[model samples]
Target: MTEKALTIITQREDLPQLFGKRIENQAAIEEIISKIEFESRSITFDIETKDGQATCRSLAAKIASAKSALDKAGKAKKDEYTVTTKLIDADRNLAKSRLQALQDEIRQPLTELEQREAQRKAQHEANLAALGFVNIQAHDHVGSDLVKERIVFLENTVIDDSWEEYKSQALEVKDNALRILRPELERVKKREDEQAELARLRAEQAQREQQEREERIAREATAKAKADAERQAQQIAQESERKEREAKEREARLIAEKESAELRAKQQAEDAAKREREAIEAERLEAERLEAKRQANKKHRDAIFIAAKDDLVAGGVDEEVAKQVIKLIHENKISNVTIKF
Candidate 1:
């Protein structure tokens, strides 16, 4: 029987869904049992006569189907469609009997699997209970909302009345349990409390750092803006100064040009005046020179005329005047002249 049990255990472990489906079917039967609502005084035979036999038969048929599927899977070779010699090698009745024996053998391992599942659930609850202590300690913290960055930890579930009340009303239970369990529960609770405190402190520090970083960034931006404004102002001032200097230089150039024009005009006027004076002085000097030449020519002509008259008066065709007169008397009865005086 033990050997057979081991064999069925191995088979069920090898094919868990076959057994899992069977268990699910059993749970459905229990659900049906709950729905019937039998009084305590009710007899078993009455229920069995109506629904129990039918349910058992249905279960048997399903079991048979499961066995057939297992047999087929076992007979299947890894690379071929043909059954292996393990089944073909056995007597036909013996193989069928061995397959049938597996159903009865399935009970114990399934119970053990349930037990292990229960233990796993218990451990999970214990861990949750310990974490609940941390949650309770965190109630005192002001900004726990900020600290809880991840998903919310608590969720609700429905159970049987007794278990349901225990979950819904865990506070009274925890307090009582803490009193009895003493140092163990206390230690776990204290550890979680310490962790929550540490998390809170770390969150505060991070907030401070974020604020400081923002302040620094703002200061740098302000400084850069101020510097840019100052540079623009200086540029504007320089441009204005440059324009002013250009205007002043233009003014100076215009003044210089005007002064040069005036000087040139004055020099031309002076030159023209000097030329006119020279022309007038030259005309006067020419008129004086012509008058002096005319006067000297008249004096020379007068002197020549006087000398000619005297010569004519002093001598005619004669050498002596008395002789010339005697000649004249002899020719006519005119008076004679004195001889030589």
Candidate 2:
């Protein structure tokens, strides 16, 4: 509403002949865009005003129509060009195939020669590589043994016509590789020798240090043992006086105990002898008493046996037979006829 609400009413007469057609009119489209841009400046869209909103709707409708028409036109043109593009591509591909075949046929011998030479060159390169020609820096830190192997391989390589036109190149490569590798091998050998010598020196130093350490330890131990022995001797000397006194006291006490023990032993021996004499006298008296009892028993037993034998003789038994019967009863040879003694 700052300006007056305005609209541009475009008709078909204002457009180019190809404006919504299958052809693109660059100049005409540019003119149409110029005209719209100039007219759009006048049409200020103010949504707060009815007339401004109406003008904005009309311009939007116009732009939408133009956009639709342009899209349809592009589609129409593309649809028509599709067949022509396909035909051109088919002819281009066929010509490409035929021309490629002819070119291949024409260059067949050259191609074969080129391939053979390429293979030959590849073999030469492989041989050179085997001789350690490439990546020489990779061996800068390698060991002497590997470097010697490379030198040996380079020296062993036969440089002859079998290498073909590259024979001289192969020789040069071999020579250069050997030139680099030989010095490297020597350097490596020198370095290894230095390393071995260094290690030997270190080992000898370590052995010397170890021996020194052992000797120091042994000296320390000897000193410690001597100190301990001195201390133990001092302690033994300190204890010797007390031990001597105690030993003398113990010997005197043992002597007193021995004298008392001897006295007790002599008294015990006399008591044992008296007890033995009393036992023998008692035993002799008991033997005499036992003998008297045995004599009395024998006399009673004889009297009983004689009385019984006389009764048997009176009962008409023979004298010798009665004697035998009495003897049998007296000796307890007859059952149930023992005389009580």
Candidate 3:
């Protein structure tokens, strides 16, 4: 025969005791999630598909329905967290506001009463300060111990059963102290004012003297500068006049030299012309004398030649030989000649 198979099943309650509480808590959380999912499914819209193009009205209605569902889901999911947070915060803030209001109601009047008491005390102290109560000593009749007692009483006064009585007593003491010290303070103030006035007058006098001295020095400096400027102007004028005179003299000398040079050049040119003319005249006269002497010599020579020729012919020589001898003499071919008879 085949053996029968046995399977063992473990129940949650039969599991270890330590896991029971955790399992129970997980079950509770799952149940809450299931309920939330059920509600979400109930509100959700199912979109349908059509084969052809959808009509505008149907499409718009579907879009509107989908958007509304999305918005509602988002809001609901947000509220799931925000609702608890808002409740806790509101309860905490409301409790705190109520406690604060109660505290303020109790503290405001007490604070105002304390502030008024402080103001009264400050005024009282200010009155004492005005009288110089702390600075100036009381007279011999009003002892220091009594003054200390009065200050203590004013400081301790409050808005209580005996505030009016203590305040009046303190004011009376302050009045008596002021009455004793006012005359002495006034006398001291008058003496200080007189001394201050005298000092101010002396300072003004010194300042005036210093200002006058500075003005005098400045005037002297200005006068010296003016005098120096005048002297410099005079010197400049003298130098300029000298320069002008020298310039004129140099110009005159240059003009005279130029005229002298021109005159000398003209004389040289005239002398050269005169010398050239004299040389030409002397040359002409020399030529005329040479020509006159040449003509006289030629005439004497011709007469001599004629006389010799006649002697030769008269001596019975051949007429042609005589003529030939005369031609030789005329031509100077014979240096010396004797005619034979």
Candidate 4:
């Protein structure tokens, strides 16, 4: 019981609010309040003492228990047992409010005294905490544009007496936040560049494939024409040889010989055309093979870079900074990062 601290709640006007509203079981309410008052008398206001703190804690617990009992007996029980809702509400609200108000009156000065050092600390700490996060992380969920906007806003923020003695700490937090944020923008930019390069490669590959298709069509048409010519010349020589063996054997023999030479020329021409088509097809296949190899190597290397970047991001590095780091590592420029081929 705080005989010394109790003086703070002893104003003559305070006694009226404690017994003001007429409610059910007034006798019980009065009994609880009386018990609290008697117990509080022994709680002599020495918050600096360990026993004083324990007494204050016990007093707070008792107050809370009493408040709960009063609330349950009125606000909730009225719902279970039959009672006029309006009447119950009025009485219950008044009882609960009076109880809370009385408790506040008793605790106000004690609380103020108890939290003196903490209050002093909180006064500056609140401002320092505000300085650290002021709109810096507020725009994070919105997107990069808003985040960038917030960074600009933070940069423009005047760091002076408003931040108090925590100006340097505030500035450092802001700088660190920006350092993490700036890299995401860079990652976006670099990703776009990579996409553009991949697009160019795809376009070039399409063009080469199209050109090869057209050339293949032309080669097939040429081979067909040469085959037709060779077949016609072969048939003519066969007929000429047969006629020479039957009538005007000598003259027919020379005519057959002339046909034979023409047949030889046609066959040679057909062979040459076939060899040319094969050479062109081989050249096209070789080119395609080289491109495929190059693309595969590129894909493998890109996977490495992407994996490195993603791992960095997972480890809490900013996205753009991670991308840049991967690039530097792959290029053998960043010796500090623990990465390998």
RMSD of each: 36.4, 23.9, 20.2, 53.2
Model 4's alpha-carbon lDDT is: 0.71
Cα lDDT, all candidates: 0.56, 0.77, 0.63, 0.71
Inter-residue clash pairs, candidate 1: none
**Residue 224, model 3, lDDT:** 91
Using TM-score as the measure, the top candidate is 2
TM-score to true structure, per model = 0.23, 0.40, 0.33, 0.23
The list of candidate 3 runs beyond 4 A from truth reads 1-82, 102-115, 125-237, 240-244, 260-341
Q: TM-score for model 4?
A: 0.23
lDDT of 1 by residue, 114-183 (tens): 9997877776577446534533333433243422321133222222343433454555544544444344
Weakest 10 consecutive residues of candidate 2 by summed lDDT: 1-10
Put down candidate 3 lDDT per residue, 55-85, tens digits, no spaces: 4344445445544544454465566668899
Q: Tens digits of per-residue lDDT for model 2 on 1-341?
A: 11222232234433334444433545545554565566666566778999878888877876676666555655666766788999999999999999999999999999999999898888878876676553543655668877777677777778888877878777788878877877777778888899899999999999999999999999999999999999999999979988998999999999999999999999999999999999999999999999998999888888887888899999999999999988888777999887655
lDDT of 4 by residue, 154-228 (tens): 677677866566778777877776676577556545656777799999999999999999999889989988998
